[model samples]
Every structure is written in C-alpha cells, then in structure tokens.
Target: MQPIVHPVVGYLCYAGYVRASDGEAPQGELTVVAVFAAVLPDLIDQPLWLIGVTPVGRTVAHSLFGGALLVGAVGLLARRRGRTDIGVAFAIGYASHIAADIPWHVLAGDYHELGFLLWPVTGMPAYSGVKSLGTVGAVDITTLWLEAILFVAGAALWWNDGCPGVEVVRRYVG
Candidate 1:
C-alpha cells in the first residue's frame, strides 16, 4: 500500500467505528492522533531502514508484539489522563495500518511478506525488487486503482463527518 493510502484507510476505519458505536463522527485532537498513528509504523521503520539501522522496511515497529506494547502503553497513559478516546483512536489507526498491509498477501498465500509481523521471532523477508527508498517507484495498476477508490471513499466519509479537522488545519496553516 502507498503511504497516502494508509492514513485514508485508517480514518475511514476509525470514523466508521465511531459512527457505528457512538452514533457520531470522530473529530478534534483524537482524529489527529488517529491519522498520525495510521502512518506511525512506516514512519518509524522507513527511517530506520534508510539509515541502515535495520535491514528491512518492516522491523520492530511492524511486529505484533510492538503494536500490542504500544497500544497497551498508550491506552494506559491516556486512560490515566482521562482521554481513553484518544487511546482508542490511536489503536484503531495503528491496527488499521497493520490490517491494511495484509489480506492481499494472505489471499495470495505469500506469507513471507508477513514475517515482519512476528519480528525477531520470524525474520522479515527482504521485499522482492525493493532494495531502497530510491527504488520504490512503479506501483502496479491494480494498486493505483484501489488507492484511488479508497481515497474517494475516505474523502466522501470525511465530508459527511463535516470535515472535522479542517478548522485545525486552517488555524495552523493559515
């Protein structure tokens, strides 16, 4: 999945959950947290790989153990701060990222790509044909189409949610 697709999918999942459970749209700082969390795995792993700190793009950050530890620690901290909602949003986003990376590979029985989910317990296979960040171009047509569709769906959902974070962006960017 493209970097752009992750946050959109994350927001869609979080917003859908909020709508289903709370009968309301997600908004405010929690939305920001969720969006950031959506890409946090890539943010951590990519840099480490680029700097030669790790041998692959999926390392400690992409592992189930890492995700569980992060979510648990954040949940406990946020609960103590009386903002469990933030923790929930973060978990949803983080989980969405992990979920988004799977399915296609699983359906194809390419479990080697998923070894990173186990981290040290199972070594991450080097991505076929992807050696470095500079070599990461040329997305497949099917992936492009899927990304476009997801982007449209996410945009429509955000608009339906009354563009929750627009004001924050406007306030900060302007």
Candidate 2:
C-alpha cells in the first residue's frame, strides 16, 4: 500500500475497534495518534532505505515484537497519565500497518519481509532483495486499487461518525 492508504486503513481499523469496544466511533487526539502510528513503520524504514542506510523497508519496525515494544513503551507513559485509551488506539493502529502489509508481502513472495514480523525469534534477512527504485515505486503505486476501495470504506466509516478528524482536533486543541 502507498503512504496515503496506511492512514485510511488506520482510521477505519481504529474506528472499528472503538465501535466494537465502546459501541461508538472514537474521536479526539487519540485518533490522531492512531493515524500516525499506522504509518510510523513505513515512514521510519523507507527513508533509511532510500538513503542507503538500510536495504530493506521492513526492519525491527515491521515485527510484531517491535510493534508491541513500541506500543508498550508508549503505553506505559499513557498509563501513568491515565490515558491508556490513547495507547491502545496507537497499538491497534501500529498493528493495522502490519496486517495491511502481510497480504502484499505474501502475494509478492517477499518472504524476507515477513520474517521480520517475528523479530528476534527470526533473525533478520539481509535485505529486501529488490534491486531498483522504479521497482519499489511501481510496487507502491500500482498496488493501490484495493487500497483505493479501502480508503473509500474508511472514509465512509469516518463520515458515519460525522468526519471527526478536524472537529475533534478543534475541540481538544482549541
């Protein structure tokens, strides 16, 4: 999925979680956290790869253990502040990124990408094994049809809750 699609998926997944847990859509700053958390993995690893710092998009960031550790560390802070809801939302968002990537990885036979999800339990594969920038861009852009539909679905979910992003921010940050 492209960068845009991750946040959409994050919003929908987080909203669904909120709806499931609270019988209503979630709102406020935590939604913002969830959205950023969803894309944090790609945002982190992609730049490093682009700069030749790493040869892979997936790293410790892509692993379940890594996600858990990140969310857990953030969670501890939130817990201390009595904001566990924020932590939980971010955790779910991070998990959603991994969930979104798995099918694509499997479809592409990028098994090395998947191994990182198991983290220390599975030693890192040396590189993504892709040789060209065009190939990477092609993969991200061309594979967006399903993501387009998912974006629409996620927008509908947010619309159902009255498109709360801006409104929630206004209320909380004003």
Task: Please list the residue runs of candidate 1 whose C-alpha ends up more than 4 Å from where it truly belongs after superposition.
Answer: 129-141, 172-174
Q: Kindly give the stretch of ten consecutive residues in candidate 2 with the minimal lDDT sum.
A: 129-138
> Candidate 1 on 1-174: residue-level lDDT in tens?
678889999999989888899899988777878888999999999999999999998887789999899999999999999999989999999999999887656644577888888998998888653112222357434445666799899988888888877777777789
Question: How well does candidate 2 score on lDDT at residue 155?
Answer: 83
Q: Report the C-alpha lDDT of model 2 over 1-174, residue by residue, as the tens digit.
A: 667889889998899888888898888777888988999998887887688876566776787887888889999999999999888888988988989877766666667657778866876666443222234544743345566789888888878877767766777679
Locate the minimum summed-lDDT window of 10 residues in model 1.
128-137
Give the lDDT of residue 6 in candidate 2.
Answer: 90
Clashing residue pairs in candidate 2 are none
